[model samples]
Target: MTQLKNLLGFLWYVAHKFQRDRCMQSASSLTTTTLFALVPLVTISINLFSLFPEFVKVSQAVRNFLLANMLPDSASRIIGVYMNQFSSHASQLTYAGLALLVITVFSLVITVDHTFNAIWGTAPRRSWPSRLLIYAVLILVGPLLLGLGLWGTSLVVSTSMGWAGEGAQATHSALKVLSLLILASGLALAYYKVPGRPVKGRHALLGGALAALVFELMKNGFTLFITHFSTYTLVYGAFAAFPIFLLWIHLS
Candidate 1:
């Protein structure tokens, strides 16, 4: 009973902190920045996969996984088509154009760094060179890690299905769990590492898990709203996907 009270207290405190930090504004800013950076990021990911032929299948799987799990049925198809178009155009960029794309991507990272710093009440700790290196590593390695995770999860699911004769429902449940865990783990790492001050790992983990749970709930609620409501489709027509995508990014 005491532990439950403590947990409630902690949650209330975190909610207060989040409100005080103007996280909604930060999220709005992130959504705007993401709109500009999405194509470049996708292009980069596509280029990375191209360089590693063995991982091409993993990349495709990751895309499919995200579309199926993270997005609403209405938004996923339209967004996927837009992403493919943007990435194709981005891939043909000249060196100067590529540099601009990199800059645009860096702007998103800088915004994120500032947002985290604001939430933590800390100044930037890393120098520009170090920050650049870290950002580059994150941009290049993050998708690869996600692809590998998807690949591994697929392998496990396949093996399990073969051994246990599990049905599609079991496979989907496993994938959902994997997605939740991966989201939570990534959030935990960011919570631990992004702040200038030291954060306890357990605290970060707890916060991350809670946040991931909330995000999953939000995603489901948003999907349900979109599924039932055709207002956006009626109002925006073909461009409805853009706003829905932006709203999802902000909520996320």
Candidate 2:
């Protein structure tokens, strides 16, 4: 009972800190920024995926996984329309158009950097040149890495299926675990590196785990709400995804 009380007290303190930091305001700003950035980010990712024809299946798998996990059914169709619109135009983009896309994506990255710096109580955010270089690398490398992971998972599942007839369920469970681990690792790295000041590994790990756990619960809970009770469709009409995404970003 004492331990439970201590845990509750710690959580309350954390909630107070979060409220004092004005994270909801920052999240609102980020949601708007992300809405603008989404097309550019998707365009760039599609271009990246096009580079490796052999990983086409992996790219599709990742896309399907994300669509399944991230958006509720009511909002997914609207989100898909925008995604397809961006993807269709990616191949036709001229050099100048690509440059604009890069700038837009980087704007989102910079905003995130500022948010993390503020959370860490750091002053005078990193120079634009340095931030640009880092963000550029992340933008270019992250999707390729994700595709590779999905490809690897596919191979593992195939091999397991061939070796053991009953391995499909096990493979699916393993892949789910792998995906969670990947999410946790990315969160850990973000928490550790985004802050201007150096953060302890344990602190970063704890933060990352907490973030990932909350994200998972939120995703499931939000989906359940959408499935059973949400009247967002009626409220927002055909453009329901916009508001749903905005709310999800703030929740995240």
Candidate 3:
């Protein structure tokens, strides 16, 4: 009974920490950035789902959905155009989205670094020249960084494919293991480079790697828990992804 109570207390602490850690101070900017992120998120989510098998099963139904209840004719037409484009050559769209998403994410990453720096008492000199330099670097290098990150992911996936006979999930556990670290490295680069502070890449990389590991473990654990234990509405089932992803980012 004592152990159970302690565990519950720990979970509550984690939830509270998540709420506090989320970059809510930059909410308006974050929302705009998230909107920008949506294109890539959708692109990546669709591709990953098709590869993962779980999402491919419902893609047709999902497509049928937007086609049915679309509001304005113009909006519907745009969606139709997007869908057509999406189905024809997903890689092109994914690449485009990946390019855009990287810029958006790096912008946010810099903001996070600035905010954290300010809060942590090591705020950098943000003179006009330095600020301009930051903007220039962000605009020029952000997309390239994103492209490299995506290429790294593609390499892992390709390597996984050569080993697996049919299923795309045929990669070794080791490959799955390295993917998180690779992603963390990209994030660490962004975090370290974006900040005006003197944070070293090694420190940011370690922090990012730890955070990524916990986030992945927690995400999978929560998914398994929901699949095995909980039940929710039939109509609004798909939005579960929102809360899960949001919570992970918040907490992580």
The lDDT leader among the candidates is 1
Ten residues in sequence with the least summed lDDT for candidate 1: 160-169
Per-residue lDDT, model 2, residue 80, is: 72
What tens-digit string does per-residue lDDT give for candidate 2 at 1-252? 999999999999989989989888889889888888966785577568766787677677667556655555645566677778888767888999888888889889889888888877895357868878888888877877876786688677868574664576766676677777777888999998888888899988888888878788888888788778758789988777677777776676
lDDT per residue (tens digit) for residues 1-252 in model 1 = 999999999999989998999999999999999889976675576567756779887778777777776776766786688778876776578999888888999999889989998999998788889999998998888878887888787777777664555745676787889888988998999889888888999999998999889988988899899888869889899888888887888887
lDDT of 3 at 193: 61
For each candidate in turn, the TM-score is 0.88, 0.89, 0.48
- The alpha-carbon root-mean-square deviation between model 1 and the true structure, to one decimal in Å, is 2.6
For candidate 1, give the lDDT: 0.82
TM-score of 1: 0.88
Per-structure clash totals for the candidates:
0, 0, 0
Candidate 3 residue lDDT tens string, 1-252: 999999999999878764675546545455555444534433443444355454453444333332322112223344456656655675555666657656664565456556665444575657757766766565444434443444455446656564555334543343355556555775677567655567776888887887667656765665566567546425448565444444434443
What lDDT, from 0 to 1, does candidate 3 have? 0.53
Which segments of candidate 2 are over 4 A away from where they belong?
A: 124-126, 162-168
* lDDT, residue 203, candidate 3: 88
Candidate 3's TM-score reads: 0.48
